[model samples]
Structures are given as structure tokens and as C-alpha cells.
Target: MKRIYNTLFIVGFISLFMSSCNDWLDVRPSDEIKEEYLFETGNGYRTALNGIYRKLATFDLYGSNLSWGLIDGWGLVYNLDKAPDDGGGRAMKKIATFSFKHSELTPTTDAMWDAAWNIIANCNNLAQQVENEDTLLFYDRTHERDMIFAEAIALRAYMHFDLLRIYAPSLLMNPGERTFIPYVDKYPSYLSDRQTVSYCLQHIIDDLKKAQSILLSVDKSASFSMESRFIQSYNGESRFLGYRGYRMNYYAVTAELARVYLYAQKADEAYAEAKKVIDVVESKKWFAASTSSSGFNKGNMKMMEDIIFSLYSTDLTDWDQKINHLSDNPADEYNEHYLCLGDELVNEFFGSEKSSDWRLIYQLEGKYYDYYYRTLKYNKQKEGTTYSKVNDEMIPMIRMSEVYYIAAEAIYKTDPALAQKYLSSVKKGRGIKNVDYSQVTSEEEFINMIVSDARREFVGEGQTFFMYKRLKKNLLGMEGYSWKEVEAKEENMVLPLPDSESNI
Candidate 1:
């Protein structure tokens, strides 16, 4: 909590706000802020918002933990026993087993909550300030002002939805009244618990919708431009107009709304919104170059061409190879750097079409790593190599393919044919010749297909846990717990609120 205040007062917050527009989104300042004049100019507001995005990309936030570290480990994407002794190793194993109360897991979980809430508090501060800002102070005379405000709102909802997904129970599992976490709306919000699952979810959806409405006119990223990946002078519009893929623009907001509706079990609305994204993206012919593992081995490993929203960092190349993908397997299994699957899990994961899956062909071959079989999803462009500037150092938060999956999942029960078409399209994109849908006669089988595809499609992306949690399904256990049945605890989807929040 004190961290949040320290941020608002200064401690790099003010420095980031005062940074030149050219480097606003690039470098985070070491020194802090001058709170009194933080919002005096339009650049101040822009820098303030950029500061929040930078925070979101920190190692404690999406840069590692929430993206592919803690959440993915919990999703059982990696073999729990293979968890390394350092770099969140014990915490990863405990979280995988739902040992939320264990001392090993406390620091990680508490940091997750604190880091997320700190970003949310900063969002609240920006929202509070921007509402009263003079539109004329902005470069585009309300366009930039409105864009920042809308982005702030959408980002707030995005983080809130994530917090709700992590900390609270879903309506599907618990229909009865139950307490939920606080919906901190304003700056310096007194975190309290008076909300319900229904109340918090509705507010999140409402906030997204409000953001979408405002961004409708301000945003031009219906089909995102590749140039949006970089910050350049578009007649002094680079700060706001550029970087749509990283920031929360109109389509990202719409995509997020579809995700929320699906979570709330409103399949029809979810399908409608998802279809909107799919149609626009396809019509625009965006990501047409995305084929054969969607830019694997070509430096677009993160699938940037089709990514709807992502987070960027300059530090990705430093720790990615050594930490996630080690050159050789450790002598002690428990001493491994990160979790990875063995031949057995790999065979089961790929099933009969092992040769067809491009992920196996490109991402996991021994050529990439001399000994260990690891997914090279996060490796970025470095000192050499002729990959495009947009190829590396990006982590996808959501992408067009997932939107297709959402559409397929949402409408499967009512319209299986359309659903299969949607699902098959994605499979086809992954280089599969033909998908046999005859065996998926039942809705359960369809969902199983979805789960299998998601597990395969998002190997190191950390989406598997949320998919499991949303559907209230069991997590696939590893090592001591067999895939079939080693124990009888239902899926540990609910990450308990930290003592700091709970005890308060």
C-alpha cells in the first residue's frame, strides 16, 4: 500500500511524467515525480499513463509472473517436479499444487496482489486527473485527451477483470451470495469488501463498454497497423496514435468485452462481440503473413502479427534463454531452471498428429536448444539476425486467434457447425490438413477439443489456467499426481486472497 503512495508522490513516477515525448514509453525514470504539476501539460498526462503501462510490463507484473511464470506453472503447462530451485521455484511448485497458504508461495502471491493493485491505484489517479484536464492542452484538441482517458478506463477494467478472475469465485461455481474483493474505483481508495461477484463483474463490464464508446471516434486501429508497433512522428501524434497493439485501443477493449461476456456465461453476447473482432480483422486482411507457427524461427515467435494487445520490454533477451530454456538438462531434476515437459507429456499433448503441429516442428526442435526440449516462444531479436524490428521482445496479452477460440467456445452449444468452422479455421492456420469433427458429437467433447487446442496453442502463454478456471475444470496434475487420478482434490482454480487483503 505504501508503495502505491510512493509511486504517486514521486520515486520515478514524476520522472517518467517529465520524460520527453520521444522517450516517454521507452525509458522509465529513476528519480520520482513532482506531484503538483504532474498533469499540468498534456505530455504529463500521457507520461502518467505510459508509466502505468511500464509498470504493467515490470518483472513482478506481466513481464514474468502473471504471463508465463506463476499462472502458467499453476496451469500445469510445465512438469512441477522440474521446477528450478531458484527464480520462484518453490513458489511455482506450491502454486501448482494449490498450496496458497504455504510460506513458499506467500511472497509471490502477495507481490502479485500488491503489484497489480499498485498499477490499479495509478490508473485511478490518472482517471481522477484526466476527467478535469483541459482538452485544449492536448495536441489533437480532445482527441489525444479523449484517447488517454479511454485507454486508462479500458486498462483499469482489464486489470480489474484479471484480479476478479484470480481472487474471486465465478458465478458458475457459486450461485449463492458470497463476498468478493474490493472494486477500488478512485485514487487512494480504501480497499474494503462490500461487493459481490455479480457487482464487481458488472462494474468491470460497464467500465469496458464506457471505454469503448469513448474510443470509437478517437481510435483508428480497427485493424491495427504494423507501424503502430513503434513510436514515430505522425505529425506529433506518435505518443497517442501509435502503439495501439501495446495500449488498450478500441478493438482491444471490444475483445476484452467479449472475454468478459463469455466469463459471465452470456454466450450470445460473447459470440456477437467476438464475431465483430474476427470480421474486422479478417476483412482488413491483418496478419496475412501469420502462417506456419505464426512466425516461428523468423523472429515473430511471440505471434506479433496477430496479437491484439501485448507488453514490450528491452530486457527479454537477457534472461529468457538461460532461465526458461536451458542449454542442457540439469543433473538433478529438481534443480532445473523452469518447468518443461518430458517425452511422455509431449506425446500425450501432441496426440496422433505429432508431425502436423507446427509448434513441435519449429518451437521445440533440438536445433533451437542443443539438449533440452523447450518452447522458444519468448526469445527475441538480439545483437545480430535480420528479423524485422517488430519481431521480438513482445509478450502477447491477447490476440486474434484467441478471439476466434472465444467465438468458437461461446457458440459451440447452440451452433456446433459454425463453431466447428471457427475452431477448424484456427487449426488450419496452424498447418493442419483436416480436422475430424465427427468424434466431437457431444458438447463435452467439443469443450475437450477446445481445452486441448488451448493447451497446445498457448504453451508458454499462461492462458490455460484461466480457461480451466472459467470452465471450472480440473487442472492436469504432473509428477506425483498422475494425469488420470493421484488425488481427489477438485481443480484448484481459486487463488485465495493474500492475508494482507483478507485480514484487512
Candidate 2:
């Protein structure tokens, strides 16, 4: 990944120098060296492909949203936090209200929309450019192009999937009535209309399916590190560019597709997609964590064993932004008062069986001291820091444990015993006692038990809000809010489109 970044820096310098030259007459036609022209060669195509990874690393794109906002932002949908009304936290509050207007969302949301589409546009360009070329022109061109296409297709699908979750209504099982986001198969000459929510999701699924097909053909040996991938200055300042973790490979793509499918509620497809990860985990070859002091940062053991895909920070410092984004937390980064849901809901989820859950208890300090239990998993270190500026954890995008939960869920739909087997697999991985599902008699009882297990397995991992959205239920105190303000509708199951994109 660092090699790719170095190559991109060189490309950027050449482009800058060429642009600065006033005497284009001394050289061949200046346009001959442009992106369009340069990409005509095999190496140029490779560069363009790598450029996709680079683009995803930008702050306005995946670097911020995919791992941060997409996870944290959707946490709002489930009332995970009480988003503050002042400053940066305001937009997230607006999302809770379903009142987002295009003029009100931040530039970040707008930039993210454009960045996502830029990837799609570039991928489309590549697909068009490579169609007529023969396999014999370059080194493993056929294999490379296929892998590139796979990556791009997954990326495009991911972007659209993000949009659908944020904008469209919940997807009903019926294909004919499902809502979707805009679909852009070919680049438009002018603005095009949005597709139905269902259409958009289907297209995303289609793209992912295509990605999975070609990904199966790619080489899998890729290594990554902070030194080479990050743009570090001699004095230690760094521009956070390059692959977030190691370069994304085939396994990551498949895992991501499984997530997309799960959200779409395509149980059968979700199962099949998740099975790919199950196979990997069973082999003990993928998703292991590293054994460093800051293991949560680079060289994470958890990342090696169970993380299917993640974006790495250019440096450990980047975690500061995530920890304190939109808020103020000085010890680490920034902090904010994004409203977490009231205690009633938090406790209800934990239940009276407190002994059975550890995450709910980990925050005993915050709960007993402040009356509100802040997330302990993301707390800042006590090293002379303020309440703001304190992001200091690696946000995981996909974890292998999710695969176990997914398989468990899928298995429950057909065979209870089998579902119990998958659930036990996850428990064993967590070093917990193996649970036997034979003890569960009723279907509803079995589901509730499985969901409880999932809650234990994925606490603060960013899957709660999605489950809330899918179940279409309100947070525990939603009724109280509705009574207190009469008009305070609980928009718990959906996320509004960023007003900026809606207006566009």
C-alpha cells in the first residue's frame, strides 16, 4: 500500500509540474500526458486502479464516513447517543428528526457523496477502457483487470449501499415495493433522477455479486505498514493518505458483501456470503489480532484474526479525530455531547441479568459516577487531556465474529440445532462456555436468545443501530419523548438523506 502511495505522489508531482509549464510548445501536445492519455498504458491502468484505493483514504470519503460516520452516524438511528444541538453535532440531531434539508448538511456529507460517485465514475471508465484490450498485452493483464474490476464493483456497491441506508425507507421483502437510491450504470451527460430504494439496493447487490465473481481470480499476498503507506514528515507531522490498513484484498470484499446482503434481508444470499468468512475463520488463517501494546492501533491482533476489512489511520494520531470528532476531548482529541439514548433503553437492552453481560458492566464507573454510562470501549487515556479532542481507537468496519452471528441467524431460520452450533462456535472463539440450543424450545424463545447473544457479542461494534432499523422499533424512552413534546416523533428506524444531496 505504501508503494502505491509513493507511486501516487510521483504521479501527482509529474502532473503538477506539467500543469505549471507555460511553454507547452516545447513538448508534445500537453494533453498527451493527461490522466486520460497516461491511463492508456498497462501501468497507467494499474495506477488508476491504485488511485481508487487512494481516493477512498481521503478524509471526506471512507477515511471519515465508512468507518466513522457510517458506523457512528447510524448509531443515531438507534438513539445510541443524544446528539448535541450546538455546532458539529447538530447535523446528526437533524438526522434523528427526519428534517434534514439539502442546505443544512455539512460539506463533509456533500464531499462524501461526490467522492463515492467519483469512484463509481472511475470504475465505469476502467470497465469501458479495458473491454477491447487483449490479454497478451501486459503482465497478467487479464487477472489484474479482473481483480481491479472486482474491487471497483464492490466499492461502487458499497457507496450506493451507504446511500440507500441513509436515504431510502426500510426495504420490505417485496421487490416491487422496495425503495432504492440513484442508479448510475453509465456516467450521465447531465443529472439523472434517483432510482427507487429497492432498485438502488438491487443494483448494489448486483455489483457486489459481480465483484465476488472476479475477486476469486486475484492474487492474495499483500503486506502493509504505517511507515511506507503514510506521508510522514521528518518532524513527525503526517498527511493521512494510503490504504487505511493493508491493501484491501479478496476476502475483505466477500465479507463486506455479506454485510450488505444481511442488511438487505436477503437471508439466503446473506448466508452464502457469510459462509465465505466462516470458511476462512474455520481455517484459522484470517482475522487475527497483533500483540502490540497499542494493539488496537496498527498491528492489531483482532484485525489479523477476525477483521475482514478495515481502514488504517495514517498514524495512531488519526484515532484522535474519530474519538473526539464533533466533540471535545483534550486528553485524546475532541469530544462532543451527541445525545446517547436514555438509561431506560440502555438498561432494558442489558436486562436484569447483568451478570451475563460484561460490556454493560464495564462502564460501572461512568454509570455510578455520572448517572450516564458513556462508552468505555472508546474512552480517552488520562494523560492531561480536556473533555474534548480525544479520539484514540481503531474503528473496525468488519469483524469475523459477525460472520458467526450471521451464520447463526441464517441457521435459526431453518434449523434450531444448527443455529445453536454456529452460536457456540462464536462463544468458543470468545473463550466462553459452549451453549447448547437444544434447551430452547420455542422459535420466539430461540430468536430472542440468539439476539441476546448477538448483543453480547457485538456491543459497541456498530451493529446495534442496524438491528434497530431492521426491527423498526423505538428506543426505550421514545414513548416518553412523544408524550413530553407530543410532536416528538420517534424516527428510530430510518436515517434521512443529507439535505445537501437531497436538494441536488
Candidate 3:
């Protein structure tokens, strides 16, 4: 039987105290109200927006699967061993090998599809309600209505873009090609046509543009003239109020614009958008690199300033434990079930630079267990707070370092000097020596340097595969295996649609 996907019509709002104690941004809807009542008030719209964020923090999305789990496994970065006869390791092996044909993947893909679409459905419902109602009627204290509406639009675009990355072909290989994932705006009627990559990207850009316009207007308003007003927390006294890096704010929208342009192969456009963000970061001094050797150490939330958009999750420890603790014996600390850094990547890519790079020296290590080098980026659990306290570790969705990388890649063709400057910005931030563009003899060498830096910078963040796919670069294998580039016609680059969509 095909499981019917339904929207959560009634969303209950949780108190700030309770919300902080549990999931980072989950809005537990305690009341069963009609959809009409839910959208009638400004608080209703806000609650609905919070619910969307909560859905994104699920195990199927950024909380686990998308970040350090399935996606990174697919990138072939880890050493994945086959499961024992107990049958628990089959799914892990399939994900590590990129074998999506396993029956286990069906549930994973299906959950992703359903969760993403359900969030989109809610965003559509909120958007329609905002259009139908008057801003003056609802409590306009915080410019709540417009802000919530804008967030909904931006998040809708964000989810759609991720879906495209996972399921559609790279635009480089199949420009103007159509018919993959649907660009769903309205609630699905079970008959939405599959959209082309070009069409979906255009729609996503349109939504982000709308959100940017709304936020700009809010920034210019007389009562709340400060730009921080858009990202202020519900609790006035909270330390995290002004630090709205957790929410999709203006800068995040701009960053996403740059990313989308890069994915669409619009180099010039991407360069411009990325430069705009770089200029803003410079003018506002909104970010700084981690100076401490243990800057990205586990249990640390000090790097929040460097992050542009991060999803809050109190259940990070739980998720980390589940992935790291695969053995039946609790005392076995050296179990091989954990994912290790690729041997070739460590030997070839970071050969000489590994010692100087703090990102490598501190972030990547094999000290957790013998012959098991694991990434501690996501291991942020405090010593005494396991299963009892809320850890503030966030899943970084976008960061300032990424913006610099984007700018470097986009402008390297037209302005090599300027591109090198942008690239060196990240290098300097990471305490590494600056790169001399004049020293780089060929464009291919420059590009390879950029990709290598990205590999080092974004380890365990699930960006390596997308970087490889977007550039059609060869997927690097472990020491014994030969590297092979993914062909344009390869079906594995993008996952197949779920059985529900196929059945429909």
C-alpha cells in the first residue's frame, strides 16, 4: 500500500523554555486547530514556520543523513566495512558503496521525499494565507507576518534546491534537459509535472528574490530600522537573538543565490553574487576564522560567528552516538564500524600541507581508536550532559568560508588575480600561507588547488560529492583502487525517484 502523505494542519506552539530544553527549533503543536485558525494570527504563521525548521532537523535531513551520514558515505570518503551476518550492516554498506538499488534505500529516499514535500506544502499554505490576510489585522509588533512569510518562501526554495542536487542531473551534462523532480510550489495534487533543472532553478531564484525584497523592505522600515530585527529571537532576553545565524537571513539568501548560480553554470552571475557577500562580510565584520587549535573541537559552540546558516539540534549527541557506537560490546572503543578518512585522500591530497593546516591537524585525527581516523566536527557532546542537557551544536548549512570559495571559482577565468585574492582570504583565515596567483602556471592547476582546499575545509559536511559531481571531476578512490570520473549518462549521480512518485 502507498502511504498517503498528509500535511500537519494543526501546529501547537511550544514555550521558549520547553523548546530550548528539547529539539533546537522544534515547535510541538499541542493543539488541534483548523488550518484556517492556524494561519489567522501572526503567531500561527510563526509557529508554522518553526514547524518547517523542526522538520528539517529530522534524522532524514540535515540532522544526520544529509550532513555526515549517507551523503558523505556516497562520496567514498570513509572506510566502510560490510555488516556481519546479523544483517544490521547491509544499509550502511549500501550507502558507503553508492549502491542505491538495495531495498534499504527505498525507505531512506521515501522519507526524504515525503519530509521535503510536506515542508513545501506547509510553506505554500502559509504563503497563500499571508496573501489572503491583511498585515494590519494581525499583531504587527515584530513585523511578524511579513518576516514569517519571507522565511517560508526562502525555505521553500532551499528545500527544492537540495532536492534538485540529490535527484536531478548536473546542468553541465544535460543542459536544457527536463523531466526529473517536480518544482512543487502549491500543495501537491498528486499530478504535478516533473520539472527540468533549468525550470526548477529559475523558480528557486524567483522565490529567493522575493524573500530578499521583503527582507530589504523590513530593514528600511522606520520602527525597526536595524537589519538585526529580521533575525531577532522570540525571547527578547536570549543571547542568541541578535545572532540569527541559525535562521535563513539576508546573507544566507545571498549565499544561496551564489551557490545556485554556480550549480547552473552561470559563472559571471555567481561571481557577482559571491562578491556582494564578501563585501558585506568585510564591511560588517560579521565573521572571523577560528584561531584556536581546537577551534572546531567537539562540545564547542564558539564557532557560531563563522557560520552563516546553521540548523540547531539538541539531539546531536544522540545522533553521534548512534553512528559511532555500532558494536555490541560497549567497552570496545576501537571498533571498525566507524567511518574513517580515505587513505588516498590523506596521503595524496594533504600530503605535505597536512602538518601546517590547523583544519587538518586539529579537525582530522585517528586518536579516537587504533587504525580508525574519524572526524570530530560533529562530535560536540559535553562530558556531563549526555542525554540530559541540550547541546548547542549546530549543523552548518552555509558559512563565510564557502562564500570565499565560490567567489574564487566563479572569477578565476576572467580575473585570476582577483580570484587568487579571494582564495587566499580563506587560506589566511585558516592560518596557512597565502597563494601567489602568478605562481600558478595553469588554470587546471588553479582549479585543482581550489577543489583540494574545499576537500580539506568541508570534510564531514557532505559537500565533497556535490563538488565532484558539479565539476564532473574524477571520484578519487582509496589507495588500492583507481580513480574514475563519473560519466554524463551515469544514473548513479542522481538518485531515482521514489516508488510513490513513480507509481503516481
**Which ten residues in a row are the worst by lDDT in model 1?**
13-22
lDDT by residue (tens digit), candidate 2, 1-504: 111111211123122121321232334342324554555666566555556655665555555454434344444422424344443344544444444443455454555666666666666666556655666544566775566556666776776676666556555423255433456655422344667766776788788777777666563443222333221233311121223234445666677777777777777887888888677655645453222224333322222344555543343334323443456454632134433434554555555544434345442223322334444443444443321122233445566677767777776868777777776765555444545455688766775665666554444455655554554433223322331111212343444444544533
Model 1 has an lDDT value of: 0.70
List per-candidate RMSD values in Å.
4.5, 8.1, 5.4
The predicted structure with the larger lDDT, 1 or 2, is: 1
In order, what lDDT does every prediction score? 0.70, 0.51, 0.65
Top candidate by lDDT: 1
Off by over 4 Å in 3: 1-6, 9-32, 82-92, 137-142, 219-243, 292-302, 325-334, 367-371, 383-392, 434-439, 479-489
Candidate with maximal TM-score: 1
Q: What is the lDDT of residue 118 in candidate 2?
A: 63
Tens digits of per-residue lDDT for model 1, 1-504: 433322342224333232321233333334444544567877777777878887787767787788877888777777656556566657778887678899988898888887788777778788888876888988877788888888888888888888888877666678357766767778766545547778888889999999989988877543365545432335555545676777887888888999899888888888898998788767876533355653454465555666778877666554465465563555553444545665556666678767887767765643223323465676655434434345556777887778888999988888899999888777776777688887887888898887887777887676877887778776774563356212212336677777755654
Clashes of 1: 5
For candidate 3, the per-residue lDDT at 120 reads 77
**Is candidate 1 or 3 superior in lDDT?**
1
